[model samples]
Target: MDVHVVSKTDNNTHATFSLPTPTSPLAGPSSLRIRPSLLSLTSNNLTYALLGNQLKWWDAYPVPSNAPTPYNDASAWGIVPAWGFGTVLESTIESIAPGTKLWGYWPASGHVVDLALKHEPDEPSTHWIEVSPHRQTLLALYNRYLISTSDDETRHAWEASVRPVWQCAYVLSAYVFTPDPASNPAIHPYPGIPSVKETWTSADADLSRAVVISLAASSKTARAVAHNFTLRPTSGGPLGLLQVTSAPGPIQSAATALKPHFATRAVDYTSLDTEEVAQWIAALKPAKILVIDFGSRDGGFEAAHKLVSQDEVLAKAEFVTVNIGYQQKVYTMSDVGAALASAAEHSKIQFNTSPVIEAILPVQGATKLFAGLEKAWDHWLENREAAAPDLQLVWGEGVVGEKGIEGAWTRLTRGEVKPEEALVFRI
Candidate 1:
């Protein structure tokens, strides 16, 4: 990976520097400052912040001098990068390095330059470089902020950590639906009004019912969905939740915790033949189902299809489902296509996404506790709340450096990443 040195003003203005030839890898002989990137300065692109203002997206890299390798000693934070770079695609903030494996993004902090510059008149992309030693901090941030977010896990294992992705999620959710970020309840089964242009409230703001959370227990998104449902007035009756999961223990405990607010209940796949699942879902004739998982995509669609085929009771509610796992490498491009085809074939449902929170919400922040978000609004929908599944989030992949991106590009072009290396991260 190439590392470059950046010397800037207090407000991140550019300075003079020289590029080293192959023989002179250290300092450049040209005393004049290096040329700045001619790219237009857009408010959207940034690598650092100075007094909340856009500072230069200065490129930092490691010199790898004879001295020991240098690394910033920051604590853990997840929601960092994937393995390559994207031109600020999904999220507003994008960080690309020279060579490093990526998981996701966290809010970025300082960076150390590491690239050795070599000029090419035809190419200016490699002008900036860094080693990306912040991977550990990003991961730790994810575990701390996003994972331990539930009301139960408020005191996370690593409260000291900071992450960007988690912050994004909290902010997006808070911005869209609720205002209070510090303590969004564990079972917000009834999310209030949304500020977004498009939103889907309950079928009849007055006709309430339990929210059917698919892939419950295991998913934090589902937990949030269930929490949204619970906040509603029960003149529509209690938020009778029917959670489906293969893992009974943790899920049941989670559901149990959801108690009176959601009146939590559970069912296993094997029980589908019995009325156990049907009766539970039939209670409010749940108008909506919120899916918080991709791993369950196939099975979830099949289940919804079966229920819709068999139950006239649930026929009235429009089934709403959203897949946020678009970039999660759980399945390759082909696998995702196949999954879509299979879901369409099995279920009458088709996705018509609402851009309530379009950006990929990376979990970032203090470990285990919910910090406030930057912008949050209401969830927009057409089918209303009775629709099964209001949302689903699959942790997306991030961009790495040029060479690492080349390797991923080569593999992606051929087909996939080595299966073994993939297990390390959800992407």
Candidate 2:
């Protein structure tokens, strides 16, 4: 069996190892023996490794004790989970039989894993939750799995690459900055999570009378957010939008294709003029200004911050910063430290999809919420070519060699993967 492991302390230090396959029977009742068949690599995967210890992502899948030498040390090396499809080869639970296709989190490898799962009562028959004791600390979003019905490989590939992050975009638009406050109350940016104490009132979620700026506007999540924003009723708010990205041409083309009611403009990071942007935003006469940072390049978020903090006309309006992601690169220990410190100092409303989904489930119900999400997701999938014309899936096979997941991980660590490429693997 093949697997990939990364150093817990240094993401750049990673290798592909061929471990002996497990021969023991399923570990617990309702266990399924599964192997990740299709998976993807994105900057978000890097974030999972960088924040693994803090977020308990490392607990989801631990290295086997029998692996060779130091590579087997759980404290030093761990598997980074990826969002993808897994095929069940054996099952203790009768309802979920062998050959069943499941979609959710999986180790970024071809090795089979045994997971104890339980059906989520009152939810769709397709919904199952991982009940493994080792995974208890993971966010509920990661624990949950869905049975997949589609056989289309292209669609599956796209889902593997885009669906996970796109859901965050969906929640941010449909729940966080809710279009209809009466039906779906706007959730706190942190929402229901006890660790985050900041409050998010309706006033804070109101984009109806605001000018919104998205840094790293070409990012998949950012583009999805922009697409969702186009669906909002004109009466709901957000008088205009300013997108700052390195590839402004494609961004502007997508905005044009979406045909948002609100005014829209895209500018490259190098060409962004804070004063000019402030003047354009001031003309909108917004009641507030919201700056969403989706892992912008160096100084991109800082530039947007300067526009709202220093501009005479723009400073008068309410200012809010939502920290959604970090730049796509391997982070050093000092880089991680500085990011944590900066987030604390700025009081940035950090967005976590799990807590926000937990808060909305009761209000919207699992059926209604998931139904709505699927409808939106299906539409996006159908129109993805128009929505993200530049995105091209770069597929690889298996887990060990240069043209496989190992190579993909190396590219990610060195930041060689372009924003236009979506890396997927057949394992």
Candidate 3:
């Protein structure tokens, strides 16, 4: 088994592990072999590393360590978790067969892994659980895998690369808009007047004219949310879609093509200030506002916090906030401390700092999260072709790919990868 490992002490570097060949698997359900094909390394994965120990991300998939190597650091040898496609090579379970492709979470380090399997009642997707005991306490979503459908292989690869982030985006859409905010039990907790039959309150004039502001607008997840909003306009849609992006070029390109249908106006991060954002909110007077920040760098948090905290902005329109991504890597103890302190300062703004909160809504659990994403998934399946061109697929193979993974990590740590390109490795 050949696998990759990031230095426990350094976020910018990684090490690859090549293990001894395993004996043929003719054993029980506990014995299985899988060849991982594609890995989607986006900002979302970076968040796993940033909060790995704190959140138990490292425990999701244990990486086998080879002795006398740079990766020998016990604490650092843990593999980061990733969502991708893998093909079954050997399985003792009668339900699974060699060459069968499955999509779900996997260890980031190696090309191959042997895991325990627990079958679920057969369904349209032939569901099953990867019962890796170390991951038992983690989110059930991470443990579940669906038998990959026999579809266009390229399309499967693309979907595998993007689905993890989409899961977060989709669930978010359902939380805020689905079942109409007025009737949703979750909406009752918020201060604003709840809408009875719409996403926002029909009784509150401001709620009817609500606007959804997507920070880090260039991200596929954020764009997907904006796109989903257009598809499921059960609440008469928002007054407008406002995209806050540091690099407006790619988003502008996308917006140009999606205009009039998924119409959005891109606001440059550098030039936009709290006062300006306040003006945008105030302009939509008598309407509530929701700002979902998918950004993690260059004052992304500070600027967003300030905008939503303004008296003028909140006077006529209440502000709601949710965070989804961390484009910036928090590497060291100092970095962690600084972020904690910074978060404390922004606490005054009352933003939902974690996706888990909004995603699970009204509570925190995996089953509810998955249930909420079904509609968004349906919409994406029908409209994937139109959205494919905006994605950049970079292929990495074998030893070169191993080296490429390290390079990609370094670039991502520095926020060098362009917002338009998503890194997908073909190992």
Candidate 4:
């Protein structure tokens, strides 16, 4: 058994490890052996590592000490988390047979994982939830696996590559754009969308009158959210969308891939000055601004300040910064002010920013969130005719050995990958 491991102590470092394969996994009805078919490598995977401890990503697949490796550093023992497709090689459960396809989270290192399954009747499905008593309560979202309902190989490939990112994008789009229930009773974001029960800073200005500015606009998750913006009519004056990217290439790519009507304008963040960005915001004539940052080079502070500090923009509009992912090493946010301070340090344009809020999907449970995501996914699949961009994915199967995984990681970290390409690894 061979697996690649990343060093938590030394940033941007990784190694490959090998282990002797057991003829059979521990015998029991609960045991199953899964061999990964494909793996997704993206900033989201990096986010998993960034918040591994807080989010319990490290525990997804813990490596044993017996695994052979050059260096036995304990800090590098953990496998970085990945979302992908794995085929069940061995299963003792009667309902789930061998060769069954499973789509969910997996470890980046080991090719196969021996998981103890517990049939979670909690949800009506043929699949079972991982009931390894250790991590059962850690994070249910990462623990459950869905039985691949489709027999078509092509569909499975698409689902395996795009599902995890789309799932996140779907949830973000639903909650952020869902029309206020008080204003539009008929228009609900998700079929059974729950309220944001967690403590999120209340929106100061009328969200219905806001324009959403998305940072890292070309990202798959950002595109998904932007796509939904086009589909749903906003209560806020015409639903205006603006995408901000670091380079001109991403701007052109996003504009070309997404329908021309999807964004009002695609701005290259690095080229524009604060006043220039402010002018663009002023042109929208929005009463308020909602900044949805997917992954920014220096977080969204620079972008946030441009809107919040500009006299022309701030006089008429109030702004809110909503962080979705941290592409770099995770920073702690003790309070709103502290978060803004961190952003200010890395920002090109500095100003007294408004509330920097972390956008948490205000849903009851992971099950509910997944359900809402599936509902929206179905809606998109059914309405592909209506100016929807098909899922764009890049499969790398020809690349052999652990080199593919390491190379993918290096490219992603350096931001060398194309904006529209969703990387999937078959190692």
Candidate 5:
């Protein structure tokens, strides 16, 4: 079996190594021996490594004891987890039989792994939670897995690539900036997490009278957010949308295709004319302006923010900036430190999906919430090709060598992957 390992101190330093697969008996009772069959690679995966220690992502998968030389050191090397589908090779639980497919988080490796799981009570039998002691540190969102019933490999690949990020987009649009506040109360940006003191009031979430500016608008999560925006009722808010991205043509085309209730405009990051953008916002007569920085390029977010601060009419409106994602690049230790410090200085409302989902589950029962999400997810899957006309899935095989996960990781480190290409591996 093969697995990928990355330097804990530097994400760019990574390699694949072979390790003997665990034999016969599983690790613990109710545990299943599984191997990741399909997985995805995205800039978000890079964020997992950059904030691994702070967020406990590194704890999800430890390097095997039999790994080669330096890679064997848990303190120095770790396996980054990816969202995808895995098949059970062996199981001890009577309810879960071998060959059953599961969808959730898994190490970006082909090696068989053991996970202790418990059926989530009061939910569908298909819903299970990872009860492994080492995984307890992870958020509920990461530990939750769903038994997949779909046999369409194409849909499975698309889901592996988009579902994880798209869920964040759904929660952001539906709950965070709730359209029907009566049914879905506006949730704080850091809902259920007391450590973060930032408070998001209902007024702040009211997008009805606001012009939303999305930085890094070409990002998968940003694209999904834009798509979800189209689903909002005309009276719900968000008077207009201004998308700033490197590739504006595709985004503009998608907006045109979606026919959102509000006006939409797409502009290149390098060609953002603040005067023109200010005029666009002023014409809308918005009472507030929400800028969502989805980890734009170096000066992209700063430039977009300048438009709001410099314009007299726009400056008077309520200005709110939500930090959702980071740029697609490998981060050094110092870079990670600076990012945390910068987020603190800017008073940015950090959007986390885990706590938000946890807060929503009790209010909107798991069954209902997932049903609504599945409906929307199915819609997105059907129209994804039209929505992202330029985007295409690039599939690879196995864990090592070129045309595999290792090569994909190398390209990610160099920031060579294009925004339109989705990388998935058949491990």
Candidate 6:
């Protein structure tokens, strides 16, 4: 399951990703006991960790105060397995065959299965039911709940289809993006005055501005977030349009569907002479940018910085940067990214770079929340459109299921899940 190790299963993988592991909490590998019969998934549940495992890295316990980075100066550290997620639309699910495609797990592997309802009070409303599981699960724990005309019928349907993986990016955005600066109920303040847009749209400020989702063409979460965004129109302005890619050849039809207000501005970043992103940002003055920057080194931080420093494009609006997080290596990567992202409202030093972490709800202490996420996933599925309680944990893994990409000891070091090379056939 880790990047360095190989599995005996047919899923020969070579993919690499970051992981979070805390030095404290309990160090090193855990011996998991299998109990697949206990697995159940529901559309109603929402919070969950992989198979009842605490999915984050390091001692990301309730922040004693609001200290954002304790690992900033550590020479070496341990990492824990992290996770990623994608949206599994009914249509997309219906269209693709098993093993044909996969969305990132916000950074965790929990997305490998789908969610279902359970009677266990301590568990998430839903749990996993693997029809053709890649790895035989032992003591699997799932979260998320769904509504069916008949409970039995719904249960049957859940058993049939593959459970959706980790947290969907759009759903995660909805949860993490605290659009309203005025209403950001912080145990400790994040600094600066609230923004006008966030203040007016406090209840929906996070929902107010239309997000310009990158990698829109293929990403399930990108498309899902777009769908979710369109359903909830905010006053932030017409959902702005911007798409950038490196893949070549004829444009796919998905590009055209995103038209008019939803403009798909495509370009090849590989051949650019100088930080060419400035032109793109200037052309479409995005209010607050939410990007799904996979494949790249630093959430496009290098390119964006080049543009902002050399060109005047990024100066016009309040810019919020979300990393492909798949690129996150250090604690500062995510910490600073969120700092700059929420900077407009929180007002700190104008950092030209950083990743964002917007928790969907107020989470309990890390351990407790991880302990009871399967039911939480159920609660989430029931109200996909609704915002859950907002807990404040400023760690990198806090958003969606992305925290799964940590090291062996905790997320702090350098360990991670290695996707099966076989997935390349589908990705």
What is the number of backbone collisions in each predicted candidate, taken in the order shown? 89, 1, 7, 1, 2, 119
Task: Using lDDT, rank the candidates from best to worst.
Answer: 5, 2, 3, 4, 1, 6
Q: RMSD in angstroms, candidate 2? A: 1.6
Worst 10 residues of 3 by lDDT: 188-197
Error of 3 at 250 (Å): 3.2
Question: Between 5 and 6, whose TM-score is larger?
Answer: 5
Model 1 lDDT tens row, 1-427:
1222211222121111222323333233211111111011111111121111211122121222432222221111111111111111111112322222222222221112222222223322322222244322222222111112122111111111112222323432333223232233221222232312133333322224435445523333344344444444455333465556555455555455434455676566555556556666677566654333323423554664566457667656555443322221224446647766764553322221112222212222222222123111122122112212322211212223322222333343332422112111111
Cα lDDT tens digits, model 6, 260-341, are 3344444454422344445655566655554444323333444543444455545544554443323212223354466346
Per-residue lDDT of 48 in model 4: 65
The local lDDT score (0 to 100) that residue 257 gets in candidate 5 is 88
Alpha-carbon local distance difference test for all models: 0.31, 0.86, 0.62, 0.59, 0.86, 0.29
| Candidate 5: C-alpha RMSD after superposition | 1.6
Cα RMSD (angstroms) for every candidate in the order listed: 16.4, 1.6, 5.3, 6.2, 1.6, 15.0
List candidate 5 stretches off by more than 4 Å: 192-197
Q: Which ten contiguous residues of candidate 4 have the minimum total lDDT?
A: 349-358
lDDT of 3 by residue, 1-427 (tens): 5666765556666666567766655556555688777766777777777767766778876665543465666686667887788888898877788888888887765557776878744323456777776777675667778787765666666676677777655544544444354433232212232322233232332223667778788787887776666654544556667788866666656555544343357777764574765666566563666677776466766666566665554555665555456565645777667765764554312222133333343354444454556555766666664543366777655423534566676677887777768777766
**Alpha carbon deviation, residue 393, candidate 2 (Å):** 0.9
What TM-score, computed on C-alpha atoms, does each candidate reach? Answer: 0.41, 0.96, 0.82, 0.78, 0.96, 0.39
Q: Model 2 compared with the native: what TM-score?
A: 0.96
Query: Which tens-of-lDDT digit does each residue in 296-406 have in candidate 5?
Result: 887787777778788888889887778898989987667668777866766667899998888888898888778778888887888886677777899999999878889
Candidate 2 structure quality by residue, lDDT tens digits, 1-427: 9989999988988988788778788876899999899999898999999899999999988887777888888999999999999999989998888988889999988789988989967787799989988899998899999999888888889999999989888888888998788877888877755433367667777889999899888888888888888778897768998999988888888888877899999998865554677788899998888888898888887678777778788888988778889888988878778777767766667898888888988888888888878988897887787788888999999998888888889988887888688899998
Off by over 4 Å in 2: 192-197
Tens digits of per-residue lDDT for model 4 on 88-115? 8898877778888888788875567777
For candidate 4, what is the lDDT?
0.59
